[model samples]
Target: LIVCTHDLAVTLTQRPHHLIEYLARMKKRVTFLHLRHLYEQPRDKGSPYIRKKVKIGGVEVRAIFAPFPSPLLNIFRGLCVLLHVLLFDKHRYRVGINQGDPWIGFVFYILRAIGVIERYVYEDLDYNPGGHKNWLFKRITEIAEYYSIKVSDLVICVSLNLLRLRNRWRINRVIYSPNGVHLSLFSRAIKKKAHPPTILYIGSITEYFGLDIAISVLPSLLKKIPEIRLIIAGSGYYLDDLKRIINKYPEIKGHIIFLGRIPHEKIPDLMAESDIGLAIFPPSELMHYACPIKIFEYMAAGLSIITTRGTEAARILKKYSVGLIINYSVENLKEAILKLFMDGCLYKRFSMNSLKFSVKHDWNKIFHDEFKEIESLYLEYVLIHKRTVS
Candidate 1:
């Protein structure tokens, strides 16, 4: 099989290591890899990890990492254009993924010209519109939706919210593959931590994630348990606002720690060090059907969770007895945190249950099942297209 994917499996970003490992394991059957933009650069401060060449199942993979080029140099950009112009094959199976407009447009023309393209799969991992309030994300997402729905043979979404997003856009043939974690990677903890515990909030501190709620409830929580501290371990647009809130609360000024944007690999260590994991999102269209990966990560860490009620993520938490589920209010949130401070047996139960529950939803099992299903469907679609053309 020949796989055509975009910048998705970029190294050191979005768990590309896991995908590379999985694909390399399948080399006994795979013929070629048609990848576009296989690597991604960090937002600033350069590449996230040290570059290395490692063999996965003895298969050497080619990586193309340049997204933008310095006009003075321009060599990488020039090479990318050259690859777009020159790469070709007449009889191999084709799978066009979320490659940018240029690559997708070129593949559509080439596949139609030679007429051997089997299936076109559009996989959307980031379907959150509120993720970026900027113009760049909006414009690119709009164009991606246009071509992805207009030309793909199958559309795959990593979350159920994305499937609903497809239907809203009037795109059919959507499949849901919810984001998952590797249960084995999680540190199994038999004993739970003591009361007046340390609380943790991971990921972005943006408006969409409701960092305000976390900040507002803190003063009250501190009055109740002065020993408590809320450690925020990520950075985003709302970082400044969150900092201001912390500054305003003089009693708990030092109690709030901001560890700006640490490496993703270091997140597990941070979680393991903390006693409670926190996720608080306000009500919105996006939040309604969303299933956050943080919830699973918190569970994998075996930390008792505190989250908003009524959302899909909360419902999942409620089912698993993972942690306290409360509505989006300062009083309610303060109460929930107090319960953990006051009740030891409840925290222990939640901590134990969360780790045990997360085992069934590991990424290895989830992705393996997804890949097999997609491969089968894609193959059948190819055969049907061939017969119809004949």
Candidate 2:
């Protein structure tokens, strides 16, 4: 059973979606409880819990719509989960996974404590305690996370820096796992010559993410190589900021392609056509811990990476001998882009290295390393969900 804070079908995702697919392939039954986003809740203020399946085409969801934001949202979610526990067999799930939000972890901890779930794994994708702006909510999440960590059987951290808190308390059962890519999906995506020397920046558009820096270097890059193209995909809180940059430099509009919030499936196709993948995030202590899924996906598709200096992405690239890393400046970015274009051997070496790096980091291998037949170990107990759930 998987309990996620966000809708798997609707959000700009990576981790939870991959987990669901991985579990299904192992022939384990999935019982999904999707807590809809605040905006997705019912407008009839009183009638907020609109429960049903979203378009998770293959997974069977015993859906329960969570109402709009309230201090008791987590409590309401816990009640819905409890209802499911009462409706179905009490010990229906052998293993339970909680994705996102520390509050959800409290529910899983309770489930584990009472033997409702045999094992509880808390996958901490972003291990940031100060991520929430609200002071009260931040403290509440810290308390909940502290409780969850104490109770969970395993705590998976996506990046190395996530180990800091665990180290402080000597905790972090510490699964140092990174994000992965569906290699077969990239294999099936037909690569076409979309344009001349294209650089792709496909991810949630944000201020510190360096989309503006990519735009700023374009005119200078175009001076040397006229056909240099920039493809910017994905939308976020920083879309308005990026648009302001684009508006200020209207001449670069024709040189750039904006494919706002591309579907998850279509990302591989974009990766295939792209020559360079830009992950130019600025310097930040918090960002150093980030394991950007796009970087792994870029490697899977054999796209040369150009990441900022001293980031996890840069470290991964340098470790694999895949791509270039430089300071966060327009000139440095333009030079890196040009260098890949000018040096054939260097470009080929980077591309080959990326492909080789991807083989080991494929979703299958990563999950296998992390799970190690734990699914099969529990499969015998889950022969049939004999108890029906409403």
Top-lDDT candidate index:
2
| Tens-place lDDT digits, model 2, residues 1-390 | 777766544556577768767766776566777666557421222221133554233455655556654654755766666566657644467788776467667678777677788778777677555455577867776787777776776777777666665657677366777888888887643355555789999887777589989998887887798888899888677888777888887778888998877767788878777899989988775467778988888888888899998777888888898899999999899889999999999999998898887877788888877776345434533543333331
lDDT of 1: 0.63
Name the runs in model 1 displaced over 4 angstroms: 1-17, 25-93, 99-117, 128-147, 164-172, 188-196, 385-390
lDDT values for all models: 0.63, 0.74
| lDDT tens per residue, model 1, 1-390 | 223333333322343445555667665333334333333433424432232223456443443344453322223443453354346333344554432222243344345456555565655555434343566765554564466456776676766656776778777577777666756555533233344458888776678677777778887777777788888877666888877877777877777788877655667777766777888878765576667777888898888898887566787788899999888888888888889868999988998898888886787877787677677877787788799999
Highest TM-score against the true fold, candidate: 2
User: TM-score for model 2?
Assistant: 0.84
Model 2 segments more than 4 A misplaced: 38-51, 54-59, 67-91, 133-140, 188-194, 373-390
